[model samples]
Target chain A: MDSLAEELIQIKREGAAAVLATVTGADENGGVEPGQKCLVRDGKIRAGSIRDWALLQAILKEAEARLKEERSKLVPFDIPGTQGKAEVFFEVLPSPPKLIVVGAGHIAVPLVKMAKILDYHVTVLDDRLQFANRERFPDADEILVGDMAETLKGISITPWTYIVLITRGHKYDEPCLREIIHGPAKYIGMIGSRRRIKACFQRFRDEEKIAEEVIQRVHAPIGLDIRTETPEEIALSILAETIKVRRGGAAQSLSGKQ
Target chain B: MDTIYDQVKEFLDKGETVAVATIVSTKGSTPREVGAKMVVTAWGEILGTIGGGCGEADVRREAIEVIRTRKPRTVRVDLLDDISSDSPAVCGGIMNVFIDPWWKEKEG
Candidate 1:
């Protein structure tokens, strides 16, 4: 790969934020043509072809704003003495994280609210109109009332999409789980009892011929074992597990004594 | 990985110059969000999409110029230009697309 493409890959692998600034509009007098670009990571020019010292410095200063908002923008900059203006497009390279809540029950209500606070693009889905309406999920980015299993098949599942199956029982969860078991989701957690999950896995293995390793991806008996007692606490635990997966954190108490 | 970077890397390896067009900003409403990208080859072939329609077609024309000149440019697509048409690109918003060229490094 070329250096710029290689740098792009490394940034995504590390899950680090970087900015790609491309000069999109420039007067002929400015000399810098549109499309001349640079990549800034950690406040340094990691890879780029823009050689203007002043323009590079301007990009370094503006990159922090793009990263803070986590949004792409067209920013205009004027060199110290240049007469014309140059508009540069800053493309934030971090893919926005998304959450797909499979059931719009009690746990999902708080879960959707909390996920939105964490800046996740949250979607709530269920098979019943009474349960999956806007009144209950005012903060949800999207809500769908349809066949839970079939709706999942149509939705695009990306590596950044986190799926949580908290249906009333395993019968509902099982159908949804089968649709996305081997798909490319960052996290797939289903709520169930330990014994019930074991039986479900056995059936999946014997009858459906799914690989054990693939079945292992599902976080059955989902959530961090924080001794959750209420639906609110359970929702917090589920969100915590997804955070740990995305940030690569060990679920350890941050104290001197264990 | 389904990133556009991987596709760009493949084309660069083949010694082909390509233009990567990205929607940097939008006002009012837009078909695609910011950072949506589409890759245009020298032959005007498109790999991804930035909300296809007359707007995308306009970007394609500029992308060819970007590939030929090896110069980056920003094209402002006015979705309001043709509101009477049934094209889905009529979002009644304006968007700015930055088209940049990509090629293998010159052996230094």
Candidate 2:
């Protein structure tokens, strides 16, 4: 499958919740492009792009304000160099310590089932209605309907939130990460081989100019050092790491008491 | 069950020193499993529920006694006997309640 499709599938399986912030407004200086979108998941930028750097800076500022107030809405912004109607849309996807699994892929299916059993408020996000249906994910708290970026727009990522990105490939992972990295999620993990992660991190650093520190926060090659090879074992490792981060414990130790 | 915040607020407003018994966990077929709560005062006033019936009534009585003595205790009520003799419930569940008392402070 295509990378975007693959990434979408992975996200669905892992239940990574995020927010989609779209730039619906531009100033006279064209601070924002008409259709620019940014995905925010796990307190980080996940995917899509805001054409205008200045506009994104401003939007990030405003988005931070809205986040503090715990409010979500369609915000309009005027272009810098022109006198036109404001046309920007910013949607906040709020996921608590709650987990939002996208895709329901082989990896995500088990993840969602396990998260629910652990008492997390879990949501499943998938563009394909068939994949996101309740029968497929009976334990899910919500089965969202829409595209990865668009569906993610409705979620809010709090400190209590944890996101696992096991998307099929670079295509879905890039945009999802671009959107999510800016929010306040506690943990953001991605499943990939060492080479894939190295390349992805390199792109973020070289092209996106995302600080190395920020990029380092991401747990790529996701999960603990359990040497898991199967989907279920991989899910267990990932969940274990997530639990460790959520409880403010080190990943090396399974028992959080110490 | 109602929200604990609301229940606590209502109990506080009535000028009652109440013993709140919360069922934090349960096993088997217990009536009102985990999170079930009951509030009882030293003067015999009761509010909320912890598997109401003779077992509940007995719990309330014990709670009032706890309040009078200012001590905390965990009481186990077996519903099987109570259901056949005094209470209306026939659930055959046992409830273990941890009774804690709350009171308003007077002026210094």
Candidate 3:
């Protein structure tokens, strides 16, 4: 077998998501020993010390679920063909989340900055060259200048992608939202007022015939209800809401709950 | 960006063993989250950190032994005793660190 260290180095170099399952403990049956490992990537066993085909299949299934959730956990697995269990730790190594800011406006400035600090692979797209440039967004991983909605169609939207529509007007934002609403993006948030959002959703229902659950996936008025008063504060609230969604947090104050 | 694994690859290429210490689990208010890792050389050189301070020091000591013996072990790090101490790692929590020896033969 190839070196596990080499496999890990490759995973990091490729910026790909993978799971490292290690046997931490085993029952008296001695079916497995501690430190036995398997490297799972893209739903396949890339390499490792695990020799049991049945155990490898089980690890692959669990690794896929863990990668989707983007969490590392320790789980006990029943060793097939044996009367014992193996305690395995699934260490999830995920690539950085991609954030596509569909507008290079005021909120995009702070939003891109905050997302950079949070280690997101941020891309800022705008139709206006002046609004989307290196001068304004030095921290953004990618500064794209093109039609916002049309440009979104060219980008690959995966489950690890987050789309934030903060265009200058609904005419721009709505189209961008429509482009990604039914795509694979994990989070799609559009900036608008309550009345405007309601109208937009009505249009989706009446004109587009979009499902309610599909419309619900979008965070229309984008951000947590933190009574944000400034652009920076709004950016913070949006990122907070995004984190809440990513980590599955309640988004409620720990001290008091409603 | 010199990742921890990149450094581990360097040592493994030299046919040397290094100990990787990872916080597999934690209880209470630990300084770092689970899966935080640090690499330690056989000569006691350290790369990265697992919430430095007394808990880290203890893990470092055990890590060297793991490298020497080529064995893997788990150590429970307790920070409840030094709650009032000035150490920044005194997060009033406990964590279990799994130290595993990695060489050229083993996958990183």
Query: In candidate 1, what are the lDDT values of residues B1-108, reduced to their tens digit?
Result: 457888888898899999999998888788999889999999999999999998999999999999999877778999987778787779888998888888887310
Candidates 1 and 3 compared by TM-score, better number? 3
How accurate locally is residue A91 in candidate 3, as Cα lDDT from 0 to 100? 92
Best by TM-score: 3
Taken over the whole model, the C-alpha lDDT of each candidate is 0.85, 0.64, 0.86
How big is the RMSD of model 1? 15.1
DockQ scores of all models, one per candidate? 0.25, 0.01, 0.49
Instruction: Give candidate 3 misplaced runs (Cα > 4 Å).
Output: A252-258
Q: Can you rank all candidates by lDDT, best first?
A: 3, 1, 2
Question: What local lDDT does model 2 show for residue A69?
Answer: 41
Q: How well is each residue in A1-258 modelled by candidate 3, as lDDT tens digits?
A: 127777787887777889999887787774777788999988888888888888888889999999999988878889888888987888999977899998899989999999999999999999999999999999999999998888988998888898888999999989888888999888888888888988999999999999998998888778888888999998998888778878888874211221
Model 3 error, position A219 (Å): 0.6
Per-residue accuracy of model 2 over A1-258 as CA lDDT, tens digit each: 122223333444455544445443344455444334565554555555565555556666766655544444555665444564454444443333677665567788888878877777887776777777888888788888677756676797767677777666678777778778767777778777778878988989999999887887777877888778788888888788888776456666221222
Order the candidates by TM-score, highest first — what do you get? 3, 1, 2
For model 3, report DockQ.
0.49
What docking grade applies to model 2?
Answer: incorrect
Contacts from the true interface found in each model, as a fraction, amount to 0.50, 0.00, 0.30
Q: Highest DockQ among the candidates is held by which one?
A: 3
TM-score per candidate, chains pooled? 0.57, 0.51, 0.94
